[model samples]
Target: MNHWNSGTAAALLSAILMGGSAAVFTTMPAYAQETVKLELWSRQDPSGPLRAGNVVKAAERLNKELEAEGSPKRVEVAVRESPAKGFDDDALQLLKVFGIDQGPDMFIAAHEWVCAFQEDGFLLKLDDYIAKYPQHFGTIFPSLWSSAKCPDGTYAIPQDAEARMFFYNKKLLREAGYDDAFVDALPERALSGDLTMDELIDIAKQVVDKTKAKYGILHRPNKGPDYIMAFNAYGNDFVDPASGNLLLERDKLAAAFGWFERAVKEGVIPANNTAMEFDALRKEFYTGNAAFWMYGIWDLGSVAFPTYGLPKDEKGFFADWGWIAGPAAAKGGSPVSLTHPIVYAISASTKEPELAVRLLGHASAADLNTDHAVTTTHIGIKPEQLEDPRYAEAWPLAKATELLKITKFLPNNAQFGELNGIIYAAIQGIESGRLSADDAAEFVIDEASASLEDVVVK
Candidate 1:
């Protein structure tokens, strides 16, 4: 069952903010006397439990700290929940409609949307804030800050960054005759790219033949930035940023898609994968119906402790689950992964821009943010935060961190969403046998290149 339904971003926002106004006012009887109350907007994975409550708590904490410091006016945070679907486009449209005068005070968004937000003048330039508040700003990962900066200047501050990898069910592997020795050695082999893709396929085949597991892997079919890691591992990219042209690297892209298609054809992956939503695929993996799943670090928390309606505790079910870098496509190639940070931006229309910036800064602090990561099982962007004991207890986070060194950012372009749509259509076409791999590649490139022509590069 796909837990994630197609919901409009605006509708989700309304749902999250339901009774939020009353809650905010209840928390702050003197809120009107406060310098400013900022309305922060963000979309969370509906299936994930952490986002909404955490943001509220963070705001409460920030307000208390300010009050303790004898500041007469505390910044009150009003959060609006946004749904994950078409969220980036919705945020862009909101920025355009509201401009700087009456939009949100702050927003949580993906890194890929940074360029679009900056180009549209929907975000506040954060260079001044960062400079004045160097102590608070210095805790973030340098790479994360760089990723959030536009060519013209800095705009957003990164909130969370993620790494994607392959996770396997160790019990399933062992039950199929692969033991600890084999499992422990998988990571190094996978990283070296010497782990031939064929070997993986063979193992999946073996598992199905020996065990009762329905499928060996559960990968989703949606085309978006998420698929870039697999494509990049094979030394292929969808678009060329420098020339704003679609890359015509047919052989590599075809090899990647061909491998995926072959997995489905071989009964290693479900034939109905194209119709599966991410949440359903995850549930299948968590319930032991599947042996492997490809997903971001966000999956770590729930998978490590299987809580959704499972009769067994997560540890009991996931005790044998292990993580490895995604398999390399060739010998001597570094294992490739995609790195994208979830960034926070101030709305151009915010009534409390300064307060919103302060709240964002406080939340991104190394210690405080590390706590959030530990609780949510997210990877930390700050180097110092990784050393914290809280992060140390999160095993999945530590494993994900190991994969970060080899990660690459997704294609950052104004036309990224449209490009992803083209890529997804082509992938579906090839997988379903509606088009040849070569034809699909050509179609993706032609459509993407045309779309890129209008993308503002700055």
Candidate 2:
């Protein structure tokens, strides 16, 4: 519920003046030391709280530390205003701002776009500062560092990440004739590699036949990176190990599309899935009209239960819902959930880079980030963040933190956008029964070549 506004200074000064002795107020200069402004930009979240709330909290923390340390400089935060829109739309607007040489001091964005920003030289290389300030940068999970780096250098500090999984309605499955024990063992079956993709879909098929639910399984309505994990669960490697380029293995294409094909044919998935908005898909799962829903963990806590008017208590929210890391595509194959961070990247164009890093260091502290994590449905970025009492008390954050260890990541390539577009389009075609998996595979290959040109390695 914290917000950054233009009146923060006035409020701060009023609180200080009211609390202090009259003698101190008279002795202190009528105008205190100059305050350096830290401008930050993060996409406006749809619910719960602002994404930049912690950054403002961090600046407040840093100000206290600065005064205690006898430093003259004081830092205040300014959150740049932008249209309240989806992630990509806000990102494009930032890019347009950057075009006119007017980027913010720091910005928060999806790690997938880091590569594109680095290529454009829009990001500040943080190698020196990260080395000097080891406490802040040194402790990040090793896997996540890849997202902050390119062949040139490390450019950002990761904020937080979530485990993307498929959520199923336990009550609906029970009504659909699945015994309680079978329903309880679903995730274990998935983790131990006993559940295969076909069996997973078959379970949904049974639900459809026995229950009156409108759909058996549902996924994100639009094109993005989530389905890549499903394919990874099917034992498909999307990136070439040697070259680090995006790879499309034609052989596994059939199994990938086969899942959607079967879902549509069995009436488990609605034929008009792509036509639905995110809100409608969420309402479908919340209303118990769909047996399963797949999306990031953010929705489970931040958007679905509270904002959608479903339920808030853990029992009321999850009593009927269970989550799996999306069952493996085949028995003995690895089940996977995707994890990617939204990172804080400094603009290369900023005049006060050191001050920006200082602010970020304070902002990214465990206690400070806990403010954002507890309300936003995001898991802590560092292992130690799990120990924070606030993060520990939040049921959703506690349950999701452990799953971060088993999560997969998208390849760190700039062409990933082009690759995802082709694949998502092909998925739409295959799910609609308009393209066979083989045909979709070929179409992806052609589109990747044309769109990606020399970047894709087939």
Candidate 3:
């Protein structure tokens, strides 16, 4: 794979510029002279293309460019898939792999894990490389840089961003007697605070009561990131960004848990909500049986349209579904969107760190990233990609990106996961009718306090 032919530019340049024959280049040793295979680990994403897939594609491009430029080093990217059971599970597998010195040459991970991985010596510092290869990463969006940062150093390059929002079935809403104008104004009303969470639940209940849809509103079937938006909307500051300490108020936690508890009691959400699997929950909305679904933009391609086989430029999807940011819990309060980004990191154990970083930059370039964004339902991480014609074709990308203003991201902190799990358990208990909201809140605080000691304040 590393053999450069006589037809390469090196032969031409040697003949023209150096006044030598093609034989003059035969003795120049090729870059590491064998096909450099790099292992890349990606958490499986059935909803869309794994962000690591983008880097693999880019590495393929880099290989061709290298061969064209008469460089003997050809990159071969080997993908290692870890079960996408959950972020904690996937992160655990990665951490364990690194412990055994069997980690990949590169990896795609959530930015929230940045702090923990750096502290454990599992991540490579990229500041030096970023300075050495400015051209590859120079054009990255400044805002995305936050996803790659940690106190230790910048650990990775931003690969893709996903916005979690409220999705309603337009067809069901129409069947429930909403007019076309009303359907169009629903999301705007949500943004203006006219459509609060109470009203959202009421609307869903009405849809289910009046229409054939079996369900009304659906949230993540399992404990995942969607509920954090609800917590934030109810005025819970889960992290103290200044010191990266996990923090939450008992009153706010109770209010948020109570809202969801009411949702199940009102029959908009099922009591068995926590028992359903990811695929079944997604189908509840995509199959149009439920009035609303709270999920991320990543589903726009991998699951939503592909499951239905809808064509691009068709009005069916737009006519049948409308998306809104998560509604506020009360009147006069604003809705919130949650942004989670996947990042590409080179392994400290990699045989060739420079190649991995270069491949990441190639994958994040405007042309390559635009394709991934349009097809995978991810927002463009580069400024130039928004103007690309291919990216413009995916209508949701524009609207989703516009809604980035109200986004709340989980901070990069080690304790954030423990706090998140504590809250999710409370949600499950309260929503399942196993515990009252007050009891659930107490449980959350007690558990969180125990996990972090005095650091769990306010």
Candidate 4:
């Protein structure tokens, strides 16, 4: 038989024997009579083909284990992969169009979407499901429980968590005469939550002066979601949940923006930040042209050391890099970093919501989820998962964990995207010398409040 025909026949056989959807049969054997099929959806990564492969393997392994144990219900998993085109805005629009029934059974989504989806009645309330199934819910972290919880107290289960930090070149530091002692002291200082915006700028200048690198910090000043990290670090809460009033914390923002403007004016930062794509900025860091890069831990596995089309032991790419938690607003202030928790939520219209919940639980088991966490270097929701040897095996986990403890989530309100855009434009203006720091701060507050006035925060 031809490959296509044989594959089709296998799918049909399994579906017939299990009496479930064709999607279920494709991922499992026919002998599992009570198999449940789950359709998962995620945005495809252009650079990382292994993401889909890993999810498949995770499901396949769970199926085999269930079969061996003679479990009554088997999991049949299928993924509907789509390109990650327009960030969360596009994803939200797509979810709205798909509604509850036609959407995937369970899919990965940003934490911010949970509140909006719950309010729209598009998501199933997992609290009862979690309460009944202790094994699955117990695996998640405590902070996630709160972050994923909606104002109405219904929400999705967190799948993975991520936090940002400063990526520095250790070798470059050494070249600049910063010995191991100085490098080792960074984390403690960062953890103390005292590093102010001005201190960060001074340190960047020191690194540039000492290393003679092209620039001290390679920062992308576009109005993307990434800038939320910087804004949060400065104590600016962009969205007020209670009133849905966009609050820019103008004083704090002005200080932070002034710091950036001064850095560019002093030549410590690249003047081309306004035009730099994330990829281009990363390339500059990877190639050793920049001393510091602020990015999430997710990039460590893929970009830090490109495995393909490069020497096996590519040294300079990330050799000089060491990580430090993002600097805080003031000495002794709470060190804040941004996190966008990725979660698994069931469609309210799913034919088998219970079955979807089970599959999601299986996927989140410490053993299975750890692999993805290690691969992506994401902070897992489960505390025990943090202790997994796999996490210890990866350096990014240690750094991410420390930062995750102090991290804060962006407001989950639907208008978050619009609020972010206003903030971004203001930051761009400040960086480009089009607006003074004080003016930029006022602009962000005035514009964001006007744009998001209709979004009821409660």
Q: Pick by lDDT: which candidate is best? A: 3
Evaluated with TM-score, which candidate comes out highest?
2
Judged by TM-score relative to the true structure, which candidate is superior, 2 or 3? 2
Q: TM-score of each candidate?
A: 0.75, 0.80, 0.75, 0.79
RMSD in Å for candidate 2, one decimal? Answer: 8.1
lDDT of 1: 0.67
Off by over 4 Å in 1: 1-39, 43-86, 99-101, 127-134, 175-179, 196-198, 209-214, 221-225, 237-252, 262-267, 276-290, 307-319, 347-356, 387-390, 449-458
The 10-residue segment of model 4 with minimum total lDDT is: 16-25
1 or 2: which has the higher TM-score? Answer: 2
Which wins on lDDT, candidate 2 or candidate 3?
Answer: 3
- List clashing residue pairs in candidate 4: 141-381, 169-320, 170-320, 171-320, 194-331, 194-332
RMSD in Å for all candidates: 6.7, 8.1, 10.6, 7.5
lDDT of 4 by residue, 243-265 (tens): 43345566877877777778787
User: Residue 68, candidate 2: how far off, in angstroms?
Assistant: 4.9
Residue 62 lDDT, candidate 2, scale 0-100: 72
**Candidate 1, position 341, lDDT:** 74
Query: What lDDT tens digits, residue by residue, belong to model 1 across residues 41-73?
Result: 655454323333445555666677777777777
CA shift of 260, model 3, Å: 1.0
